[model samples]
Target: MGKIIIYEHANFRGVSREITSDISNLGRLDFNDIISSVKVIGQPWVAYEHINYSGRLMVLEEGEHNYVGRSMNDTISSLQMITEDLHNPQITLYEHPNYQGKSRVIREATNLAAGFDNDIMSSHKVQRGAWLLCEHSDGSGIQYIAREKDNLPHYSAIYLNDKLSFLRPLRPGQQLCPGGIALSSPQPCSWHPGCHPAPRGRNSNSRSPAEMGRIILYEHTNFQGLSKEFTSDIANLRDADWNDLASSAKVIGQPWVLYEHSNYGGRFLVLEEGDHSFFGTKLNNKISSLQMITEDLSNPEITLYEHANYQGKSRVVREATNLAAGHDNDIMTSHKVQRGVWLLCEHSDGSGIQYLARERENLPNYKAINFNDKLSFLRPLRAGRSY
Candidate 1:
């Protein structure tokens, strides 16, 4: 919590009020647009010119102000505290995606064109005001508006992987896309931002050839633990000491088609370029064979069934968080998606282990993706306004 002392006079004289919480309308308290001076203690705050935090905006840091400044003087009507480390205005940068590996914090607006050029920087979390990130050193290439508390998982999909080189804070009057979350990281501008940099290996391989084509499978979520890459079709995962042990995957180049049995038999599914956390039941640790397929870019869609092999009750979905409130744990088997991508979960609200479904057909058994008649939820690719 924080406290703000608003004075009706410019030099802290006359009627005054101290606020420690959100006030949508100050008029009710007889302090509407009378603010002339201010003093803030603890967290930062944003004061709006009109009621309900609308109209002009003002960012007040933790300090004493004899006057409210030219832009916000006597125009403040409503205010809300922004929870952050007020002592310092900085952003944390992670070396690897998903807030992994080494890390560093940037306090002032800086450029990474020299020593740090096109290196590290996989994920980030803003601790202050809005930040403008650019791919080029001089602020050219790709640009993204990062607001406070933004958590970027990965930059691969946005063509920003190891591509960010500059950053600066966004000034007043500027605005960002609004809907759900207030922050977003280097997400792709569109579905097709050209072929992304060759697949990057999390552990085993450090290879990214010009024409590289490989898919890496992780034994754990968040791309941790042991991992292996595949470039050609494998008749059996056991042949390489890796059978029924794939929990996550990162695709590159062409798409990969997986199977539940050796010799490309049993239940089969396709996967494009991206990262997957949960592989689900039968396919989780039961993958037996896989073959690469040509890349395809199109809208994704999926259908869920009450029984395996496209049987019984079924539902089609094209977006995220398809609630299975009444039908929780009522899914089994499947016919798979014909276009785009999706993640099948064992719990409702798209939580728990997520099973990837990409152009797969006839999953007579839910054993491959895990749970049998226990599917609770699903979500389409690219969450919110951006991926």
Candidate 2:
């Protein structure tokens, strides 16, 4: 009896015990070589290396796929730990760079260059690169990217010579690249684009989240792509989402907002003025309902008043004959006068807000209008009707 060795990437499983016919032709074959040979052998089973979909590689295995040589499980661990469970454990070998530390998020070698190409040449932050099995599910995302240096993509990607290693949805018994080739960085299994690492970069800590143009919040945000900003739940998580995150922000999670921003430790003009969150954090200029608005109200500043129904400003100016009258009349009035009526109306009404008459006479002519209403209305003296 002799020992058996199985190089699945090739169609050879029991080379020693079953391969007494082909030793003369075979010399040396690496993982890539093995996978390529299987494709040429025209066998029932084969290995695929090129990426299939957006970026995935597939590995296939048949029944009792490989019952040959004694295989080692942990290639990185020098212990040469072997697992012969015979259960036919499915294993995909990994090839990564030497360095096992954090590296700059942005690089030409990164896969993001395809769609996540912000194209930043260099920065101050310090980081490194390497490869890993991405084994533990807990090790999902690119973690703790320095203060501002976190927003980046972290999927089953590898960057080499500025090229991204796209996969074809790997499967069982598939051949894997030699070293650890990564899209970039050491991210938590949760790391993704536009999610937790949206704003993080090499110059992270020194800059503000606003400066980074994005924000990544929470332990792991489940997303992909580089949006304008980054924040937790910015995309409004919904059903039907993508499984991985990387170079480009994906709408798989829902709403597909790809980017977001938080108040950071201070206040900013996100939605509007006065509207603020804890720590005086204000909304930026997202401008939807006036509710999210918290703007800087300067003294005697021109501000826009909004109604639950209306969009733009909800108020205007009007004048009265008495000159120093209070609010304007809540009447559908024209820009003219009947009896000593000029400069009327200075406030708003329920139906419509006041507007400057453009006619210039100041006094307005009452048209379609009633008195008090829900939103409340201030009526000035009528043409002939007193007060």
Candidate 3:
């Protein structure tokens, strides 16, 4: 152990160096000598506030306490001024060529023995064989964390252990060995407020959403309840198909409005639900288009929900009726993106032809009902129609 000397220069810049007691130059210069004539390299300069080091032997020169880090070339000696080189040669982990899905490499599977980008929390540094977490740029969020080989470090996977055990580990061959947490004289994470414990297992609510597993959206062949991107498989669906779909996606299926998702948002395929069957159109892309399809009463009531993205100039359309039990019809609502507009729920064919609200008064010809509980029936906002 020797003095961790901070030698300041004429430029007001300072550098730190470690000199052994065996070094003759340091023994020759006492506290009063100018200590900058010696040479050192690397990023040795830092502002005083940034240095975590404290309290060493002090000696003054020229009737003043020397600001020991600047402009002098002399050296001071100490046995207790000790520091550890926490940095081991780090091996960055990269993505494997065989990787699939939208997974992106957040860190290489290499050793980051030098520790985290934030050194202050070095105790939680990604260990030599620890898992590395990576998030994708899409709003869809994380793709997944991949693991590296034994002691491979940086480019490792995150699912190596159960999430009950955290993935981030430390570099190998350190004072602390594998398994069990370490004992440090200094407290790293003090008992601080707002530090919520992370969730674990299928039941534990302690897990943070960022740490959750990635869900890849596979294309749904039968895009009955899904959006346009999930479009494709619905073929023999007559009227009975609606009931089956309603049960699977968990929505009431009476007066439903079908909609193919617009070109935005990765082009999803979807269907919206409604409570009224006829309020406006004979057949249009708005909810007002649902006309009478049934002749009998005393049947189960139906409702429809619609999905909307966060964009666009928000406005009320012909089918725009805010009803209940239709939230999943719109993931936009689930993600908190409905503040600015009136979103309509629709069906799978990109058609907004109807919703299940008012059953037709005149069943034979299939006409919409008068909403506002009024006598005036509003028509769908079609190319050239006025209700």
Best candidate (score: lDDT)? 1
lDDT of each: 0.67, 0.23, 0.24
Instruction: State the lDDT of candidate 3 residue by residue for 242-271, as single tens digits.
Output: 211111121122112232222111112222
Residues 1-387, model 1: lDDT tens digits: 457889998989999888978999999889988898888765566788899977666666666788887777878889876654334457887878998987777765455643333456888888776666778755666666557888888877566778887765543321112321112224432444442333334865444463356788876677865567888878777655456656778887666778888798776555666787767665776677777653232466777677767788877767665456655355556646766556677677555655666665446678676767677777554411111
> Can you rank all candidates by lDDT, best first?
1, 3, 2
Tell me, by TM-score, which candidate is best.
1
Task: Write the residue-wise lDDT of candidate 2 on 119-196 in tens digits.
Answer: 221112222221212211232222111112222242223222222222111122211112211222233223333222
> What lDDT would candidate 1 get against the real structure?
0.67
Query: Would you estimate the TM-scores of all the predictions?
Result: 0.29, 0.19, 0.17
Least accurate 10 contiguous residues by lDDT in model 1: 174-183
TM-score: the better of candidates 1 and 2: 1
Q: Which consecutive 10 residues in model 3 have the weakest lDDT in total?
A: 42-51
Reference-based lDDT, residue 246, model 2: 22
Misplaced by over 4 Å in model 3 are: 1-92, 95-339, 345-387
